[model samples]
Target chain A: MSPLLLILIFIVSTVVGYMIIKNVPSLLHTPLMSGMNALSGITVLGALTATAFALGTGSKILGYIAIVLAMINVAGGFTVTSKMLKMFKHKEVDNK
Target chain B: MSDILFYLLCGLLSVLVLVGISMMSKVEKAVKGNFLSTIAMAGAILLTLVYYDIISVTSLWIFMAIGLILGVIWGFKIKMIEMPQVVALLNGFGGIASALAATVIMIEPEQQNQDQLMFILVTASLALVVGVVTFTGSMIAAGKLQKVISQKPVIWKNHQWITGISLVLSILSIVMVAIDTKFLPISIIIGWVMGGFFGVAFTIRVGGADMPITISLLNSLSGVAGSIAGMASNNPLTVAIGGIVGASGLLLTQIMCRSMNRHLLDILLGKTTSTGHSKGVAVEASTVVTASDSEEDIVSDLASIIKSAKRVIIVPGYGMALAQAQHLVSQLSDSLEQNGALLDFAIHPVAGRMPGHMNVLLAEANISYEKLREMDDINPEFPNCDLAIVIGANDVINPAANTAEGTPIYGMPVLDVDKAKHIVICNFDLKPGYAGVDNPLYKMRNVTMKLGDAKDTVKELIDMLR
Candidate 1:
């Protein structure tokens, strides 16, 4: 991808993301933040590509660690967010 | 995959992620929204493997599986009160991942045209700096939140000067990498060392009460790091999703800053809660007045007030989380409702250690989401309510924010608890709160101050109602 195209994609995504996130109420801000935190782990894509193309053993090992860390970020963040969201129950539900 | 087809798939996945985020605005659809986002992420991962022709990599799967297992366990084990630290730690993981990926790219640059090589190298260097900083800064923030490190702001001698020099050096190293390929290895070392030092220096001076803003800003930086890593590797999917996350974090940071009536730059420069006021005199004076009124008499008076009141608003702060009093608080609210009082919880945006953190704690105690109200929505109703019950909360309800000029909390919006006909304060002490400004509300005749552990005090209220 060209540098200009990459910059355009980032700008467009950021603007659209901001507009969409503005509608979420303060009530769900914690879950909203944690969920976005998980999305930041999308860097796993870069890590995977780097690991695949690595020429040296040291660089490959670094890429492997990156992949693991990013995956943990993705999995841990989404799981915790779901757990929190589950607790936000309405009054009419069966009470704990 | 052809370039055209690959880019089209990236666009499609980005829209799916956006739609998922939009669904998060409503409570009912939020769980499904999170699931949709997870699916989009899975799709992105699969797309990357196939497009890059790395589908048969056995070790990658092994590493990812290990991470998944650990993440699931940690996510399940974490209590709601510990959510702030957990989020901070996970953000650090994301940051370091980007930094490592950027490092790998820097070590062995892909053979490309001269123009493309320069762009990639520069973007990779930038990514490494941002990622390392976010990683170290978030670890410090997490340590502070968990009380593993001192929560007090640490001001080293000439702290600002050291922070400035480190920042400049990190930037210079990035510039060196851009100028010549030969300087790559040495510049990378300086970038890592200086970036890490800068993160610690910048974060250590921020006090505990200011953690919400700091954590939110670091969250934004982590996302920006990931997006920049995407730029280094030329991955559109990573760039787009990372950009969205970055924007979301920035929005949350803006909300937290506005709610606290603070400037982001002030926080970055370490101008935290301490305003250098002489708070000892004010605390000593208030303790004497409270001593004259016996604890039993105050409890009985508060019980009667609670029974008689028709409308009540409860204000909860970080102290409530610290005392683990959410359950007792929920019980008290139930008892008040049994006496035929209409109840609502007034939650400040910056309450607890993070944005909306108080709500999660309350939710964990089985308090229905319907009963919680934001500051703006519930502020007007305080005057009409017959009683205001403040549980371990101080600065959010402090009337000093309105009348005390030159204080840190001056002009900051607070709940109008003073407007209620009667008030009950259950806090840890008579001292001023995190803002270090005396609360004039404690001295009002209509207000009864009960200084003790909130769990015991709130349980006493519940027992009196029984």
Candidate 2:
């Protein structure tokens, strides 16, 4: 597929995935987010695969760029997920 | 092309925002459960072409069908205590998917050329390690939560050695990635297993009182996994948002543990496995006065109390949720207003299982948000108020947190309900709560203990005022 087409596919799918996950109600949120979050790790795999292909195919610059981006993405997910978990820790200090 | 997608997406997303806002008024947590959120997500994605495409549609539909069947079966068969395990297991599935993504990329590095082998190696390794930890550790946590396995700490004198090894291995995995070495996979896998083992041992060994914290830690782990996955995928938004959540979660966990006088190592080492913390010496039962004699008597008594009180603070608890008594609670509040009692609801941060659990329940009852008071705002007034009505709350109002020496819940701030001239508590029974310790409030000379369902108890009180 052409780069344009690949970009469109990526954009569309990301948007779709975002929309689906966003709509989950509070009741289902904990589980849904927990589950979907794990699945989101696939982005790393995608980045890895894309990076290797790019570098091996002589697109060295693009490969390095993708790797850098992918690392940030992975780190961010862990950050946010951990933050959300903080909400559940030992019991909120209600400061009552 | 971009404009059309953008407009369509924006328009669709508005609906989700509106729906979320609509749900804000509900007091019952059940209103905001995952089921509704997932549905809204589906609607948003489909309309905006996020996951409405053919492949996504097919996959989603398959999951939906399977989910529907399982939900139906589980709802009818599972007990309340069993629900946590079920949720935990589901969480594991997500963890596994993330790990699998890492494996797939590792086995086939299509992005190696562009990102350099280093980036792919690093991102893939991080994803694999976190994903595996989330999956296996969550399963172990689910087992303990469900009581399918013992909730005791797995102690060996050399527990420190194991933890040290795991920490070293995890750090080494990161270093391996930094160096762009092929050993990245092997090191990360070992780290993954060790981390997961710690997570499991940590969860299983902690006693029941820390269920609230256990739930939070697991939640944070899942977010970290997402962030790691996002890195491998080169996604900025995921990294930004996910990192915020993960870091904050770890920070919150530390704060909570510290507030409870616990060290992070002890909590993670599963030192709390001994139920000894809550094994309070039984106070010989004291019989003072029954807060409620009969339904008719309570009604008569409630009318008088309503007539006498000026400002009343209401404290809600898990019993309120179990009774699904938001509506009745609202009705009672209204009746109190008519009787000239100024009423406000006090919300403790951890009043219910999840954050804002009580708030959600009160919102459902159509209790105005303005009437709700968080712990900080409402605590000061407790001593001065004519009456403090506690509905199904246990620990949040426990005086032990403030007074008892070496007590498990000591030093945590609690509502000084005992300071009130009159205090009334309603619950189904006198059974010890999740803390598994007898409440001293029930023995207080001034506080009146009313045992019954919150719904029925509140109704009787309302009728008394009328």
Q: Which prediction has the highest TM-score against the true structure?
A: 1
Candidate 2 lDDT over B1-466, as tens digits, reads 3555644553454344334323422323323432343344344334423321233434333433443354344434533323345445544544555555555555545433454556656765776667666677777777766667775555666766776677667666767767756665576566567656655545555654455455556555655665565556544333333343344335434544653456666677666623545543343323434433565665455557666898898888867876877778888888877778888888775665443445545654556656777677878888778888889888778887778766666676677787787888877776665544567888775566667778888887777676
For each candidate, report what fraction of the true interface contacts it reproduces.
0.84, 0.03
- Model 1: lDDT equals 0.89
DockQ, Cα level, model 2: 0.06
In model 1, where do residues sit more than 4 Å from their true spots?
A: B111-115, B276-281, B284-288, B291-296
- Candidate 1 lDDT over residue span B1-466, tens digit each: 9989999999999999999999999889999999999999999999999998998998888888888788888889989999899889988999999999999999997533356888888888889999999999999999999999999998899999999999999898889987899999988898899998999999998888889988888889999999999999999999999899899889999999988888998888888766755556465646655555786777788788888999999998888889999999999998999899999999999999988899999999999999989999999998899999998888889888899888888899999999999988889988888877778888888988777899998988788788
C-alpha lDDT of residue B109 in model 1: 76
**Predictions' DockQ, in order:** 0.87, 0.06
Q: Candidate 1: how large is its RMSD?
A: 1.5
**Candidate 2 DockQ category?**
incorrect
**Candidate 2 ranges beyond 4 A from true positions:** A1-96, B1-94, B140-195, B251-263, B273-280, B285-303, B322-331, B428-440, B452-456
The Cα error of candidate 1 at residue A53, in Å, is: 0.6
